[model samples]
Structures are given as C-alpha cells and as structure tokens.
Target: MKSKKKTLNDFGGIMYSTDPSFVYEDKNSSPVEALANNQQDLRVMLDKKNRGGKAVTLVTGFIGTDDELDKLGKMLKTKCGVGGAAKDGEIMIQGDFRDKVLLLLQKEGYKVKKSGG
Candidate 1:
C-alpha cells in the first residue's frame, strides 16, 4: 500500500495532519499561471511612494512562481549593483535605473514597457 504524502508550510511545520479522520481544505487562492519569459508583459515604473522620496524601480506583471520572481529580482539587483526585494508578483530595485532595466529586460526577451511619469 502507498502512503499519503504530507505538505509542509513555512517554518518547518506540517500543514496538514495525517490522522485517519483528519480532513484538509486549502484556504488560499489558486496559484498564478506560470508564464513564459517571452510572454510576460512586464511594466517597469519609477515609484517613490511611501519611501521618503527615494526612488525604486518597480517591475510588475510577472506571472510566475515566487522562486522565479526572486531569481529575476536578484538578477536585476546584481545588474544594477544595488539592493532591493521581490514579492507579490513585483520586483523592486533600489534605484532609478529605468533605462538600464528596460534594456536588460529587452536583452532577456521579455516584453517590457515603461509606465508612469
């Protein structure tokens, strides 16, 4: 007989119990569809909101897993030689590198556009 598999959440905790009478129901929304690199229409914008007037390059419209998002964010941060974060389908780079970012995304074959004034 094959045993059922267990899913682990963050913090090394088991998300569901393996008890015979236990029932597991997922409460979160479905995951976003994984999009191909070339199909992603990413928007690059300059945002200084809620940052004390410090500008950040915000890349949104990424439809992929969190890992992929983080990887891309890391790449952008490295290429821009700065520090930032990636989360909620967006990559935030700590600077005003709109032109550089646009060029980099173009080289990577992603459909990128510059938004916001």
Candidate 2:
C-alpha cells in the first residue's frame, strides 16, 4: 500500500472503537477515474496570497489522477515558458498568465472559466 500523510479527516470520523473485532477501511483506497477533457470544469485565476506578494496563475477544479494532472501542468508550463508546480489538485504557474492559461485550457477542450481579479 502506498503511504500518504495522514490527517484527522482520513480517519473517516471514527476516533475509537471498543469492539475487539474491528477493521478500518480506507475510503480513498480506490483510485479516482480521470474525467474527460470536455467533462473537466477548470477555473483559472491570478493568486498572490502566500508567495511573498508574487503572483501566480492558479488552476483548480481538476478531477483526475496525479499523473494526468502532472501532464496538464507540464504542458501549461511549457507553453507559457515558466516554472510552476502541480500539487494538491491545483496547478500554480509562476506568473500571472490567467488569460493565456484560460485560452490554453479552452483549446484543450476543457470547460475553462476565468475567475478572480
């Protein structure tokens, strides 16, 4: 089994059990199926909340496996010619490229929305 950092929520609301015969089943054990490009509803926005006031084009609302997310992130970074990261179901491009990112996602058949100011 692959190990992931555990948080309180991962316990699935079961803190303790007195029963001798008990098992803890991981609900997230099953892999998530990647949604099709057309089925994906993506939001692009300019964010600067935590990066020392530096802006980044943040892409969210991706429903897919990590591999697919990485692939999409890589393509965006390459096309935009910038450094960025894809994690926690969000992509962070190192600069404010909201309009460009929106166009790129639209070209890829994803339902893209421009959000934030």
Whose lDDT is greatest here? 2
Cα lDDT, model 1, residue 6: 48
Residue 86 lDDT, candidate 1, scale 0-100: 93
Model 2, range 60-114, lDDT digits (tens) per residue? 9998988899999999999999999998889999998998999999999999999
Number of backbone-clashing residue pairs for each candidate, in the order shown: 0, 0
Compared with the true structure, the alpha-carbon lDDT of candidate 2 equals 0.91
Q: TM-score for each prediction?
A: 0.77, 0.80
Which 10 residues in a row give candidate 2 its minimum summed lDDT? Answer: 1-10
Q: Which candidate's TM-score is highest?
A: 2
Model 1 lDDT per residue over 55-110, tens place: 99999988888888999999999999999999888899998999999999999999
- Model 2 deviation from the true structure expressed as Cα RMSD, one decimal place: 5.1
* Per-candidate alpha-carbon RMSD to the true structure: 8.5, 5.1
Return the TM-score for candidate 2, rounded to 2 decimals: 0.80
